[model samples]
Target: MLQPVPFPIRKECPPGACICERERLLDDPQGDTRILRLTSEEEKRLVARIDSISTYADLQHIEERMREQLGIDLRISPGMHEVRTVRGFNIQIVERPGLCRKTRQSIPAAIRRCLDKNPDIAYAILNAHDLLRDD
Candidate 1:
């Protein structure tokens, strides 16, 4: 089953300074990204697609694809137990019973660069909870 995640929309920014389209919320001034915990069904769906990955090269290809397609620099650590941003901000994706939450207010430099270059990509990742929400 897909659980509902609350997305509180903010709408209080000065004219020409609105971040609603950039962060999908007018209140997030620090650009913290939300982490969505995948449900069992969602996890299964993802695992099924990448289960055949048997080498580091395969994983790297997927990572490159994600960067190209989503504009988010995702890196799976060498330890293979953690995922992080290019600047090393840990990104944890957990199963049910673990609630989805936001990252720390400190935006990593890699993400900051992406935001500077293209706010749209930052917006897509920042408000991923809403875009990927099941319902």
Candidate 2:
């Protein structure tokens, strides 16, 4: 089932300054990029929610909500995930794609850099692609 995640209210910013996009070589291990400017709380909540997903298909629903509510510009790659059982316990493990942000050096850096710089502007980049689909 696809649940709707609320989109955080964004403060007004200059036109075309809300988000940024960058492209890397197709052969590069990392995929394309999308930088989203969010608040500290919003970033944490979003990441936590995504991390909580137990299935790739569920992540796809979140991605769809992001595009619908947030904007079509943002990209979300759910990638691959699996659920396993052990000792009557079920665990879901997912391989998250690379997420990063811009650095003072103008090079792409880890997402932590953005979180460290300004929690208010939770700038994050998400590698948007998928390896599976829902049946």
Candidate 3:
């Protein structure tokens, strides 16, 4: 049986960037090298792929579910959180989503309010992508 030989391919890069092609010698275990920049959607797809519980084909399924339920994405760190001291005597309210001077409002306040109200919330993040799709 005969097999056809493969050929090499070339690509161009944008200005101010260098794209070098390197080929390692035989016996070297190192594989090919490459750099890739993934978009947020790409990251979500990867996450969904890695998720064992969700048999989702893409991030959209999980994202839509999360956004519909949480009104935020998995990356959305709440504006605030409440913690009870180990002694169980003191309850602390922490607001780190500092104030937005532009609107003279604090992001933490909104986050905190949401967290304080939802005691059963296991995880709350702003799923903006999924929320937007709903509209």
Q: Top lDDT: which candidate number?
A: 1
Q: Give the lDDT of residue 129 in candidate 3.
A: 22
TM-score top scorer: 2
The lDDT ranking, best first, is: 1, 2, 3
Write the number of the candidate with greater TM-score, choosing between 1 and 3.
1
lDDT of 2 by residue, 1-135 (tens): 222224432233345542222222112444322222343455566666654555435545765765454342333222244312111111122222212231111111222233234332221112122222233
| Model 1 lDDT tens row, 1-135 | 222335532223345642223333223444332223233344344344344444435545755754453233553222233323333323322221122222111123323443345544433443453432445
Clashing pairs in 1: none
TM-score of each: 0.28, 0.32, 0.19
Residue 123 in candidate 3, Cα distance off native in Å: 7.0
Clashes of 2: 0
Q: Considering lDDT, which of the candidate structures 1 and 2 is the better prediction for this target?
A: 1
Q: Which stretches of candidate 3 lie over 4 Å from their true place?
A: 1-82, 85-99, 102-105, 122-135
Clashing residue pairs in candidate 3 (N, C-alpha, C atoms within 3 angstroms):
72-125, 72-126, 72-127, 73-125, 73-126, 73-127, 79-111
Which tens-of-lDDT digit does each residue in 85-128 have in candidate 3? 11211212221111112111222233334334443321212233
Show where candidate 2 strays beyond 4 Å.
Answer: 1-37, 72-135
